[model samples]
Target: MTRGVRGATTVENNEAGEIIEHTRTLVLEMAEKNNIKPEDVSHAFISVTKDVDAAFPAKALREINGWKYVPVMCMQEIAVPGSLPKCIRIMMVVNTDKQQTEVEHTFQREAVKLRPDLLEDVQKDQQK
Candidate 1:
């Protein structure tokens, strides 16, 4: 049963370069820990808050990861009256044969503030 994991991060701005680099690192780490292969990724979606507009975070990931064939999409996050100001969220869809509980999701940096439990898990995994 293939499954997908979700993760998110808050960026300094909309510039695709930094957002992309950090996202690539996080995504790769999640994939590695969860035994997911890049080729198995059906798609990777990036959602930026309304204020971000440097480049598509997905494009940066594709370029950095050399995922030329992977489908990528970028969009604006829904505007809430007062939500996290500068956030970039990622939803990775992978063709994995693992149970949902086997998937690992990462929320790093300021994004960790959104989900402390998930961030703690990621930290524990990294220490291993």
Candidate 2:
């Protein structure tokens, strides 16, 4: 089976370093918590809000030790009114035996408010 792990995190600023660091951290945590190896991932989609134009968050994925060959793409998110700003979102499709409900979706920083129902999932990952 294939599972999709979703995550979103916010950057304090639109600086390249901040975007890179937060993007790396969020994706790493998402992969770790779900035990999704780079080879297991079919592909990933990353999107940042329009306000974030500092850098491509996909750079962080390519930097991961084993993700060099993994397919990744980045683009700007839909600019919905009142939507979260300075946010980056990642969706990864990984080959896993885990059921969809068992997959963990992570929300970090202010992005936590975007998915309060998944707060417990985020808390579990944080405890590790």
Candidate 3:
């Protein structure tokens, strides 16, 4: 079955370096948590909040050794009042044997507030 793994993270600043670094962190964590292989990823849809215009989160995927060939599209997130700032979100579509409930969704940094229910899972992974 094909499943989508969702992840979101917040950058400390709007600088390109910060954006890239946080995006990489979020993607790597999602991959590790879900046992996602680059080859199994059909596409990645990345979106950043309006305040984050310094870099494209999708560009950071290219820095990963095997992810160069994976298709990625970057977009601007809909601006909502009181929403997290400098947040980068990704939806990675992967072909996997795992069922929907088996898929792990990651949220880190300030973006963790976006999905409190996943907090325990994220904390457990970090302890390992």
Runs with alpha carbons beyond 4 Å of true place in candidate 1: 120-128
User: What's the lDDT for candidate 2?
Assistant: 0.90
Can you give the TM-score per candidate against the true fold?
0.83, 0.92, 0.91
**Model 3 spans with C-alpha error above 4 angstroms:** 120-128
TM-score quality measure for candidate 3: 0.91
lDDT of each: 0.77, 0.90, 0.90
Candidate 2 local lDDT, 1-128, one digit each (tens):
88788999999888999998999999899988898889999999999999999999999988889998989999899999999999999999899998776788888999998988787764676698
Error of 3 at 93 (Å): 0.5
The residue-by-residue lDDT of candidate 3 on 30-90, one tens digit each, is 9998999899999999999998998888878999989999999999999999889888999
Model 1 lDDT at residue 9: 75
Q: Which stretches of candidate 2 lie over 4 Å from their true place?
A: 121-128
Clashing pairs in 2: none
lDDT of 1 by residue, 12-119 (tens): 766767877777777776777777777888888888888877777776666654577788899999999878877888888888877776578777677777778776
Write down the worst ten-residue block by lDDT for model 1.
59-68
